[model samples]
Target: MCLAIPMRVIAVDASGLSATCEAKGQQRQVGLIMLDEVVRIGDYLMISLGQAMQKISVEDAKQTWAYYEEILNFSPSH
Candidate 1:
């Protein structure tokens, strides 16, 4: 199964072709090539396999992330 995580857009590149997103306290690059809408900073996107697949509302992102957090709680950290 694929796991798509909701990540908050932290910084958009000057070209607006890519962005930096933060999720689970980690930051990574996300491509916006597949997206047609204007993706500004602070937007939330559903990311999977190193790509942002869809844009989601902040409220939805919060709820989804909450569930992920709960799931993470069940797994032990090294």
Candidate 2:
């Protein structure tokens, strides 16, 4: 099973095809191939398979973050 996780864009290259995204304070560089339009810094995106799958609204980002927090809080610790 796989999932496209939500992440926030932190930086975009001048070409507009690639960006740096942050999730849970971790950063990753991903390609914006599935984006419907050009992406910019501060945009929230859903990423999978090294590609950005979709752009997300601020409200959605907040909801997703809340879900993540809940999951993390309940996760078993080693």
Candidate 3:
């Protein structure tokens, strides 16, 4: 299964070709892929497979993080 995670963009290149994102205390490089026009530093993004899938509003990012926190707390039944 593929998992998409919400991350915050930390920096963007001058040409908007690439960006640096932070998630769970780790930073990664992501490609703009035509989204650089709308995205900017400090924006939240939904990322999958090392790519930014879409930009997410601050409120949505918070909600997604909360949901992931709950999932992390869950224990599988034996």
Candidate 4:
């Protein structure tokens, strides 16, 4: 299964073909060619493999991040 992280768009290039996204205090350039809608700053995107898969609602993004945090904090007794 592939995991996609939710990131907020921080910047977009002049051509709109790429954007800088931030999540968990990290930033990365992600391709926007895969998305069908117009991307703008402050928009949340579902990111995977250096690409923006799609636009996601702010609430959805928050929920997904919360789930990720929960997984990261989980500890298994060995």
Best by lDDT: 4
Output the worst ten-in-a-row residue range by lDDT, candidate 2. 68-77
State, as a TM-score between 0 and 1, how close model 3 is to the true structure: 0.85
lDDT of 3 by residue, 8-71 (tens): 9999888787889998899999887846457788999988987888898989989999999999
Which of 2 and 3 is the better model by TM-score? Answer: 3
Off by over 4 Å in 3: 34-36, 76-78
Clashes of each: 0, 0, 0, 0
23-63 per-residue lDDT for model 2 (tens digits): 88899999986677988889999888889999999899789
Error of 2 at 44 (Å): 0.4
Model 4 per-residue lDDT tens digits across residues 1-78: 889999999999999999999998999999999998999999999999999999999999999989999999999999
lDDT of 2 at 44: 92
Off by over 4 Å in 4: none
Best by TM-score: 4
The superposed Cα distance between candidate 4 and the true structure at residue 71, in angstroms, equals 1.1
Task: Provide the TM-score for each candidate, comma-separated.
Answer: 0.83, 0.80, 0.85, 0.92
Question: What are the lDDT scores of the predictions, listed in order?
Answer: 0.91, 0.88, 0.87, 0.96
The true-versus-predicted C-alpha distance at residue 8 of model 4, in Å, is 0.5
Window of ten residues with lowest summed lDDT in model 3: 31-40
lDDT of 2 at 52: 96
Estimate, for each residue in 20-74, the C-alpha lDDT of model 1 and write its tens digit.
9998799999988878888988999998888889999999999997888799789
